[model samples]
Target: MKKLIINADDFGYSAGVNYGIIEAHKEGVLTSTTMMANMPGFEQALNLHEQYPDLGIGIHLALTTGKPVLSNLKTIIDVDGNFRNQAYYKGSFIIDEQEIYDEWKAQIEKILATGIKPTHVDTHHHANLFGDFNAIYLKLADEYHLPVRNNFTNTDSNRRTTDGFIYTMETVIQSSETLEKVFEEYNSVELMCHPAFIDKFLLNHSSYTYPRTEELELLTHPRIKTLFSNHKTIELTTFESI
Candidate 1:
């Protein structure tokens, strides 16, 4: 039988986001989540993790769209103290790899210090794989001996092309043949996804907010479940389970 590991991202983004992740875990097939240490409600997410010890928790490395955990802001921070935004804005900025690595190590240490042995590590906005940043990310994961979400999920292509009204309604579903090929080629894989409902708050506050909501729906879709039945066959193991 194939096993499945459903993950919810952005654990500490907000109260609403936290609530949504918990709900998805309780009612949906959510098996894991990535925590944003710098988010406003990070403490709340950590608290929730304490209550649900079984919930696979990992660090959501945020170098692109939020505040940095380390004080060496020169490496990750812009003119402001906040992390550089990669989700909505685009610009050619130099990444101080050493400072970035130091900050990431500090963040991982902070998460581990919280007493929750992180199952794995992933990044917000997929910044870990962005440009030269991936080297630092891979190095950290290797040092920790933790699995990372390295493979792409079809949900990435399920964005809304028409009017912004419809979400995953335009999901260009991928072929199972292709999905299988990818899994076979990659061996251990981490299909990352952000499955959530895009409410008024999300719409007003988030960037690529619509696509994210669509991503959530696609992840939970019955068709996706059926297609990836027994996701373990594709090496869909949790970050730490590996």
Candidate 2:
């Protein structure tokens, strides 16, 4: 009874990404997606959400890109008055976890303001999983009673459905044997995926490129859909139902 939650990250990153995600969901195996609250294409993402009501929407809690939802942050910003990339946070000593909580809560509130309650939560660059901010993530999830995505790998012994995720790009790799191995390895697992059309924003502002298109292709693959549709062994589900 293995369950696969195929979640597309960065839904609100841009219009191209939003279209790609919708395509992945409508024509493929994407069961869930997480959106950036402060991103430019947020409204477009919401429009897609309206068009496809069943696509599970979650918060891609941001601390790495775009402007903060709360104004005038004392810490967690580089000298350029913007949040630093994931690399800086990995070694940061001056950041305030409370600020992270406040900012993240505001991001969630923005989504709620649109009357679109999120189904679950995860973070950009996995900010919550790496440092003191993990406490903030737990606080929000517990307070809201929402599912939080943990970075679980296939090799972990206690790989429950909610434990984390196995990535298609990193693990599946366009290989049928590798795809089969995932079903063999875990009873229930969530797959974290990033699928986009690789717009200028992603090219100029982010380190990630190329693999996004590849992941989208892999997610929409006919074999992958057939595997999930077979239904007896693997079920594709959202975290809310898991």
The whole-model lDDT of each prediction reads: 0.65, 0.79
lDDT of 1 by residue, 139-235 (tens): 7877987766643222333321111111122232254665655444443334455656555655655775656655556656677556655444543
lDDT of 2 by residue, 51-148 (tens): 99999899999998987888878787777767777788667467777788898999999999998888889899888876767778877977777777
In angstroms, the error of model 2 at 75 is 0.4
Model 1, residue 103: what's the lDDT? 84
For model 2, the local distance difference test gives 0.79
What is the Cα-based lDDT of residue 169 in candidate 1? Answer: 22
How close to the true structure is residue 20 of candidate 2, measured as C-alpha lDDT?
A: 84
Regions of candidate 2 where Cα sits further than 4 Å from its true position: 152-161, 168-170, 173-180, 183-185
Best by TM-score: 2
lDDT accuracy of residue 4 in candidate 2: 68
